[model samples]
Target: MPFASQPVRRVAAAEGIRASGHWPHTIPAVRQLLTDGLDLDPGVTFLVGENGAGKSTLVEAIAIAFGMSPEGGSTGARLTTRESESPLSRDLTLTRGAGSARWGFFLRAETMHGYYTYLEQNPGMRPDPQFHELSHGEGFLELLRSRFDSPGLYCLDEPESALSFSSSLALVGVLNELTAGGAQVLCATHSPVVCSLPGAAILEVGEWGIRRTTWEDLELVQNWKAYLQTPERYLRHVL
Candidate 1:
């Protein structure tokens, strides 16, 4: 498939703007994206890193630039409980594919409760899922199963936060379904189980910036393997 056929082919800083000694631009991955554009794959792309590494920042900017709400939801959604989103979206530019679907969704884990309430307040033609009644993990899975059936750009920020091991696997399955239907997925995650999606592009985000890597070679996976092999070895430091 042609690169332009995907929802978003590339991401870079807007013309005439330079990465400064600012909040988000100080993030190495964001700086790299601004200096040298990052090309997105046609299918699933996973961003993995530690906390405060700007994975969520990049994902949020991409989603906002693609017209999704800062909180979470579809393109038309306007849910906002607070004004805490970074100012990176305004300075970022998304190079969308030539004939890709403009329809997209942003699944922000932190503000999903607000998004659910927003859905209830503004009922659509279709019946909204009872997101409140379900448990946290169940709600995430249900939302993925129901809302993620469409073909478009789906940016998920730390979706595994509310998911268990089995649910994480199920999330990967839903991602597979989306990719099969020509939809694209950009996810920032920490779960080794979640990022282990076969053939999914894995980008390590950190002080070194974003670098394309493999599942076996990922620091997250290696650390998980080490910790699992001997929990005491890792627990000793923080126990």
Candidate 2:
């Protein structure tokens, strides 16, 4: 049977996020990625692109508009309002059928500290004493394992940042289980492991615009995969 695209159940933000005159505003031309009149595929949608490709930016804007915080989206990060002044704006009157009955996880890099505090604040949470309390990568995986359980919409930015070869596979396993059980997962990543979900749709956000492609078509993932798959060849070329 042929595959069908996941229909966007709901879209939280249709435009770019708001920014003050300084920090958020000075970064780049974000408001230009306004995703008006667009919809996400229903089950699992992957935002595949490079760091500054604006994939995360657009996701962050919609997430914030959906009541999430900024890109460093930690609860500790001061929750702010939309970018009413910024040229980029999200205009979404979510259809009750899609976004109304949903739970979500929006995990970004800069705001990981908020999640750290979240775990620490729990009654059972404990403060870490080791310099390697968890390797930076380990901590990132731990966050994924700990936070991603309930059924809802989840958007992740570079979840591969924390995983080793083995751990990346483990994270992929978690995502597979989650999607198999009916949760919606969206991730922006360089790890082929995480993007290996059986039926994931990859949207490549680039200088031009969004393009749907296969996971292997992603340069970062393919390059890394090639290096890992044939280290001696890469090593020989390197020397």
Candidate 3:
């Protein structure tokens, strides 16, 4: 695809930064990202990994680097509650596509509540979704329906947290619509259903860092398959 079509084309560490033994730097995925830049596809790109594998970290850094609020919202949002974000955004560099839409939004599952409250406090010209009055999953879908209309970079961190199986399917449909409209999406997710969006590039993050893989080949998919086929087979070990 043309460089002008996507929002962020690449992500790498800023020049003159050396990898260290810091918390995030020590993570293999972060180290690899700093050493070798990651190229994003024009449409949707899903980062899938086990918990603590740095997928969320990468998504958060990319969103912040692209000028979205750390707590979640559009580039213009100033939502801030706890300052627990890492310093990786400061060291990371995002290569913006020429003539692409500069606007973007970050839907961070953990902080959407705060972002909704922020929106209420700073009401804009647009009508509020009244997120506080809706259920968690309803609020998420409402936010997406309201804000995901524009063509820009949409970064989501574990957005399926509040969604059910059918709701996950709805999210996938929304994502398809977004990409079809020239939007770019970077999502960090553990849900097999959500990441199953057709044509989405899946990157597996693990001890080996990052590697492109197919949906059928994803560990997440295989594990879910096995667990569903015979839950006793896997649950025996944990139980």
Candidate 4:
């Protein structure tokens, strides 16, 4: 993969918005991040947060701001199945490093089924073996291997939704290769496996606001570690 254009360097909400009634403004993480802005890692930037922490909202906004479909697929992918996207994209400002991104894709776990269906209906867009034919994890991997061959920006939301532990590890490799090939990846995920990429920037979203953090410091990783160390402690209570 060669550089078609420079990757996105930063993303922030445009200044001077009335925050009284906005949906994003009401979300603590979104509000703080929008005001403070985020400087992305040229290689990889991972967004880690608990459920309802606005991770998906932020990632979706970035994808839309970059002109990718609010659903899933590359900028050229025009398959629109619904109009459920938030209005945050309209208020975002993206700063480019030097060149422009020639290729980009937005991959969201929830809407992948619909995206695959769209491809099936449009034969020209359908890949070999058809995306729907494969298992969820397999289909996602195939898409990454085949469609993500070029260097560009990729925004993914909860990509681990369907991936098994092994598949998530494989994704780590795919993402590592993409970054090394001049691509930039911004992902929102809960899987420790996916977020374990070496040298990547990890940002934790919470009530305190978006700030730089380490993989070890992430609450998700901490909880996972605790569980792995003693599953019976949690299972005892839940079961």
Candidate 5:
């Protein structure tokens, strides 16, 4: 479990985007992130944002820049369908720590089915029970147990998309273990459960750009708290 104190220290957008005329510039959040470099925690860094806030865009770009597949899998798993990745990976610079990662995976909830198919086709790469054969949440847990056995970097996008509340809590536990084992995790999520991991660095993304914040300060967390406190108050309108 012993590893370097930090794997990836920071990620910064290189200058010359204006001249490069890349598509990332078109997205306001991306432009803002490019302007202000992002500092990563050695353990866990959670990227929290509303839809279209560019969290996924930034996470995917980081995964690609770190040499992982865009479709979401291990670096060895070269799975791709169509090229929808932004050029941001090519422009961004990743600063590593004293040591390099020995293992890593990029898990995008939306494309996990594709990753499972790839694994099924390649039995050697497939874990026991087969990823596709298991339920969505089960597959994610299995990946965490098996693929994340070593100290490495992990990038995840909305991993709680298919998970229930209990399952999200289970993931939080797994993440706690992973970080304790010296893994660095970058997750883009809307799940309050996933964001509530103690001591995790939370970066809130919005039209105003990204800023370091706490779980209590996040609008998503605040709304969830209010709704949970008085579901009747909000549900009355919807119902």
Candidate 6:
């Protein structure tokens, strides 16, 4: 059945993050991180930032408030959370445009060995060749190719966790095709290729908060590419 047509959900987070003070009290660069909420089209929206910039905090709050799970992580393990049975459940004064929204996550699965034990719980539901049964990169692609569905919002945190260069490009193509068909995708990633999914809106989290940036302007991508293309100049001094 086709999903019900609903008013697209709007996340209006300009700054000021708190969970009644459950999370780390001091969120660095809070204002600079999300000075304005990006209007996520009915397509891919990529969140890019350095470590400890509060990107995950924003997404985790949304997931919790909506009673949805962040895609990755194990059942027993813990992410920063308040005392709650479902970490993905919370009460926030959200100013939403209006709509029925659901959330899921696309965290990179752990190492192959860990993934095997993880998958052992889902014998029937596991992907072919199995997630644990394939190389880290292949397993990730297969899981995405098989499991990701449409007409819902999905959050992926740094999916470049396992992909090689070739697979990374392929993953980009897949994200493009998914959002073009009317689904909403919100991803937190450092991969330039993953972040540049054509129509994706790039949000950079820094000392202030979250600001919209063009795909070409991200310094990490530029520098990383430069290093990869010519390593000797950068590496010669270190060695």
> Tens-digit lDDT track for model 1 on 147-182?
998889999999999998888999988999899999
In terms of lDDT, model 5 sits at 0.84
Poorly placed runs, candidate 5 (over 4 Å): 1-5, 18-22, 125-127, 236-239
What is candidate 1's local distance difference test score? 0.93
Worst 10 residues of 5 by lDDT: 17-26
For residues 1-239, could you state the per-residue lDDT of candidate 2 as single tens digits? 02322223544333443344543333333423233334566667788777777666666655555455554333233433333322232444333233232556678765565555644544235444322367787777766666677666567777777678898888778877777766766677866777777777787766656677887787767888788888998898779
Top candidate by lDDT: 3
Candidate 1 residue runs with Cα over 4 Å from true position: 1-3
Candidate 2 TM-score, C-alpha based: 0.69
Give candidate 2 regions above 4 Å deviation. Answer: 1-36, 71-100, 122-132, 225-239
Local error of candidate 4 at residue 226 (angstroms): 0.9
Ranking by lDDT: 3, 1, 4, 5, 2, 6
Q: List the candidate 3 regions with Cα displacement exceeding 4 Å.
A: 1-4
The TM-score that candidate 1 achieves is 0.97
Error of 1 at 72 (Å): 0.2
- Cα lDDT tens digits, model 5, 102-124, are 46789998888888888777767
TM-score of each: 0.97, 0.69, 0.98, 0.92, 0.90, 0.72
**Model 6 Cα RMSD, Å?**
5.5
lDDT of each: 0.93, 0.60, 0.93, 0.85, 0.84, 0.59
202-232: candidate 3 lDDT, tens digit per residue:
9999999999999999999999999999999
Worst 10 residues of 6 by lDDT: 80-89
The total number of steric clashes, by the backbone 3 Å criterion, in model 6 comes to 13
Task: In model 2, state the lDDT of residue 38.
Answer: 42
